[model samples]
Every structure is written in structure tokens, then in C-alpha cells.
Target: MRIVEEPFGKGVVVKPIGRLDSTTAPAAEQTIRDALTRSGHRLLLDMAELDYVSSAGLRVVLAAAKQSTAANGRFIVCELRPQVRQVFELSGFTRIITIVDKRADAEL
Candidate 1:
């Protein structure tokens, strides 16, 4: 996976493209953690271009969410493709994480 970051106000938006599997999940996780640490918490993950994800990828998302919450910051996932949406649902992550259908909706 390739991670592109954009800054918006107090938050940083991370856009990851390509497959997020075991091999790439660690990089993705580190990228997000670095962004959150550097930007001081608030983050938005734009997953529109992501074509695939594994459980490892999901773990990274979960970790980021937890860390953000613990730090009193917000972490949100937006623009998930249908396939990835199903994975989130199946894993019951849809209930734990804030997921929006559009990037505009993700802006708080």
C-alpha cells in the first residue's frame, strides 16, 4: 500500500491505495501512527482507492482508533469500497469505528 497525506485544518488525511495485506499492513500502520503523532492526534483515513484489505489491515485501523481515542483525538475512516465495507461489517468493526460514505461527511 502507498500512503499519501494531506493536511486539513487540525487534522491530517491519509489516503492509502493498493492492497493492504500482511506485508503492507505494518507500513500502513506505521504511516498512520506517524501522522497522528506528528499532527497531534486528529486523523481521517480515506480508503476510496484501497482495493483490498486483510485482517492485519483491520488491526491497524483498530489500533489507530484506540490510540486516537486514548489521546482525546478523532480517527475516522471514509470512502470505503464495498468489498472493504463488507469486511468491516463481517468483523463487527462497523460498530466500533466511525465510518462515513463520503470524504465530505468525514469532516467534523
Candidate 2:
């Protein structure tokens, strides 16, 4: 997977393209972690172009959330596809993580 990062106000929008599986999760995690550090710990995950995610990907997301929380910063995820949303819902991540249907709804 390729991770694209762009500035969004005081935060950064990270878009992980392609599949986020075990083979790609490590790199994705590093990029996201770096983004959190660079963007003052504020991150918005724009998953509009993400094709798929695996258990490893979920772990990365959880780690990012934890990191942001520990820093007392913000972390939001947006634009989840139906299948991806189903995965998150079934995994109980929807309750713990901040998610929005649109990127505009994801506050920095």
C-alpha cells in the first residue's frame, strides 16, 4: 500500500491506498506514526481510496489512536467504504474510534 499525506489545517490527512494487510501494515504504521509526530499528533485518516484492510491494519489504527490519545491530541477516520465499515463495525472499532461518513465531518 502507498500512504499519501497532506496538510489539513493544524493536522494531516493520511490516505492509505491499496490493501492494508500484514505485508503493508508495517510501512503504513510507520508512515502514520511519523505523520502524527510531524503534524503535532493530530491526524485524520482519509480512507476513501483504501481498497481493503486486514487484522494487521486494524492493529495499526488502534496503535495510532492510542498514540494520539496518550499525547492528548486528535485522531479521526473518515470516508469508509461499506465493506471497510463492516469490518470496523464487526471488530467493535466503531465504538472506540471516531469515524465519520464524510471527510468534511472529520474535525481536526
What is candidate 2's lDDT per residue for 1-108, written digit by digit as tens?
A: 788899986899999999999999999999999999999999999999999988999999999999999999999999998878989999999999999888788778
Candidate 1 lands at a TM-score of: 0.96
lDDT of 1 by residue, 27-63 (tens): 8899999999987789999999999988999999999
Q: lDDT values of the candidates?
A: 0.90, 0.93
RMSD of 1: 0.9
Clashes of each: 0, 0
- Model 1 ranges with Cα > 4 A deviation: none
Error of 1 at 94 (Å): 0.7
lDDT of 1 at 55: 96
Q: Which residue pairs show collisions in model 2?
A: none
TM-score for each of the candidates: 0.96, 0.97
